[model samples]
Target chain A: GDSVTQTEGLVTLTKGLPVMLNCTYQTTYSPFLFWYVQHLNEAPKLLLKSSTDNKRTEHQGFYATLHKSSSSFHLQKSSVQLSDSALYFCALSPSNMGYKLTFGTGTSLLVDP
Target chain B: GALVYQYPRRTICKSGTSMRMECQAVGFQATSVAWYRQSPQKTFELIALSTVNSAIKYEQNFTQEKFPISHPNLSFSSMTVLNAYLEDRGLYLCGARRTGVQDTQYFGPGTRLLVL
Candidate 1:
């Protein structure tokens, strides 16, 4: 069985501030980690994903490094914008699982002016 | 680019009724399609996984009798939720992927189900 954990339930910050959303996973097989962002009343969109350990992947000003040693793929951004407010989910698909994804209990990010 | 489309973006049904939703993949073949339900205040729960050649597999607490899936081809899939109730109300999403060709699973704008 595979599981993903997003420790923060909600993160509220002001615009221009840096933010980091913690993500950690547990699985028996090699893990493919993904970061998905969902706006209010919208479908979840893929933001970034990585399977290579320790290699950083970036998309839309957000970056995450899959650390096999720590089993973590934390999402970070240098500067948060008002549009960055949304629900962030960390999903894990174990290698050989055939496209089955186990998602975390998403983290809601709220950026204020 | 790969895209997945779901029909009937929103639907409402009476309690104990059944509802069906469809998923279509464009620009690529969808060898595998997974159905997930995102309930309020809860995470996405995988209802079942349907592959092109293999039989559909349902997760724990989900039964084929309750949620039956049909995957007749590589590009399309449909699922029906029988006996819908208040607990079954959620956004049902379909995640489709091309086996061996890519690892990313493209998701469709889920069909929101409301049970009255």
Candidate 2:
């Protein structure tokens, strides 16, 4: 079975500090990886995705490199803002599976001003 | 641009009852719709995947008899939770994907279900 794993359940940092959220997956087939961010009481929004290994996909100030060799797509940002506080999810879809998503238990990030 | 809308943003059902949530896709055709449940303090668990003109596929813990799905058209789909109970209470989300594009899954503001 294909699955995604986010090692951090909660991450706290101060504004202007660098932050990184770890994500790794397991799949027998090539998988499309996605990063989603959800604010309080809001729907999860697509942050970034990549299927090409070693390519860094970025959106809105968040960037992640999908490393096929390591099966990792860790999300990173140079400087965190208060608005970055939210729940982040790492999802996987085996390319042949018609884009069905298997999400990891989200990591809740809190950036204080 | 793609947007998915879910009806009845929030609802409460009595234990042993049932409720249905609807998903509508706007802007682009939704060739496939997948339903997910986010349990309290937990991650999103896939309930089922419904592709237009194809049979719905349910995960191991989910059954069509328990969570009936109707994906009659390209843009609209509905899922009903039968015999709602404490374990069934959570946020139900519907993700829509275009026919040719098999990468992005646009999600709707999920329906929050409460069992009383």
Candidate 3:
């Protein structure tokens, strides 16, 4: 079985502050990790993905480095913006599974001005 | 770029009735589609996985009779929640991925269902 765990249920920050959402995973096989963001009333869009260890993958001003040794892929942003308020989900899929995604509980990010 | 579209962004159905939602993939072939339910307080729960030219697989607690899925082609898929109840109230999302891809799932806007 494969599972994803994001401990932060909610993260609140002021504009221009830094952002980090913790994610850890457990899998029986090599895992592919992903981060997806869902804005209010919008679909969840891919933020970043990585299968290689210690390699930082980034997109849309956010970045995450997969650490196979630690079994974690923590999402980070240098500076947060008001527009970054949304629900962020960390997901993983075992190498042998086809198109099946195990998702985290999700972290609701709120950025204030 | 790949885009997934879902129909009837929001719907209201009474208990004991049924509602169907569709997912369409554009710009790329979707060899597999996974259905999930996002509850108000819980994370996304995988409902089923539908692959073209293969048998559909439903997760534990989800059955084909309750959540029937149809993947007739590479670009389209649909699922119906039969006998909707209060417990069925949630956002239903369809994620499409190309065949052989392990973790790349393009998600649709999702249908918000309200059971009364």
Candidate 4:
């Protein structure tokens, strides 16, 4: 059984502030971690993914490091923007499972002016 | 470029009715498709996993009788929600992956279902 846990329910921040969304996972096998962002009324898009422990993966100004020792892949942004307001989901899947994604309870990030 | 498209971006149905949603993959063959429902205030729950040439696998609390799926080919799949209820109101997403790709689940614009 594989599962993902996102601790933050909602994160509110001002523009230009740094942002972080905590994610942790549990799986029986080697896991692949992913971050998906959903803008209002849009489909969730893949933001970043990594399976290498302690390796930082970056995309679209957002970065996350997969820490297998901690079972965490915390998403971070250097500066928040109004457009960055969205619901972010952390997902996990075992290496052999074909596209079977276990998702966490999403964290809604709201960036205000 | 790969993309997944879901039909009927929004739908309203009365309780006890049924609704069907379609998923189409473009630019690649979708050998496997996974269906998920995102209810308000709740996390995304995987309903089923349908792979070409294999039987569909439904998660706990979900059944093939309630959520029938058809994956006839590599590029298209569909699922029907039978006897909709209040708990069925949510966004239904379809994530697809080409054969041999283990972790790449590309999602489609979900269908928003509102049950009355």
Model 3 lDDT vs. the true structure? 0.92
Residue A113 Cα positional deviation in candidate 3, in Å, after optimal superposition: 1.7
True contacts kept of each: 0.60, 0.60, 0.72, 0.74
- Which model is ahead, 2 or 4, in terms of DockQ? 4
Estimate, for each residue in B75-98, the C-alpha lDDT of model 3 and write its tens digit. Answer: 999999999999999999999996
Can you give the lDDT of residue A21 in candidate 4?
99
For all predicted structures, in order, the TM-scores are 0.94, 0.96, 0.95, 0.95
**Clash-forming residue pairs, model 2:** none
State in Å the error of residue A88, model 4.
0.5
Q: Tens-digit lDDT track for model 2 on A1-113?
A: 99999999999999999999999999998888999999987778899988888988889899999999999999999999999999999999888444589999999999988
Model 1's CAPRI class? medium
lDDT of 1 by residue, B13-108 (tens): 999999999999998898899999999888999999999889899999999999999999989999999999999999999999875666778889
DockQ: which candidate is best? Answer: 4
Which of the two, 1 or 2, has more lDDT?
1
Candidate 3 docking class:
medium
Sorted on TM-score, highest at the top, how do the candidates line up?
2, 4, 3, 1
Indicate the residue-level lDDT of B76 in model 2: 98
Residue A34 local lDDT, model 3:
84
- Scanning candidate 1 chain A in windows of ten residues, the lowest lDDT window is A92-101
The residue-level lDDT of candidate 3 at B66 comes to 98
The DockQ assigned to candidate 1 is 0.63
- Per-model CA lDDT versus the true structure: 0.93, 0.92, 0.92, 0.92
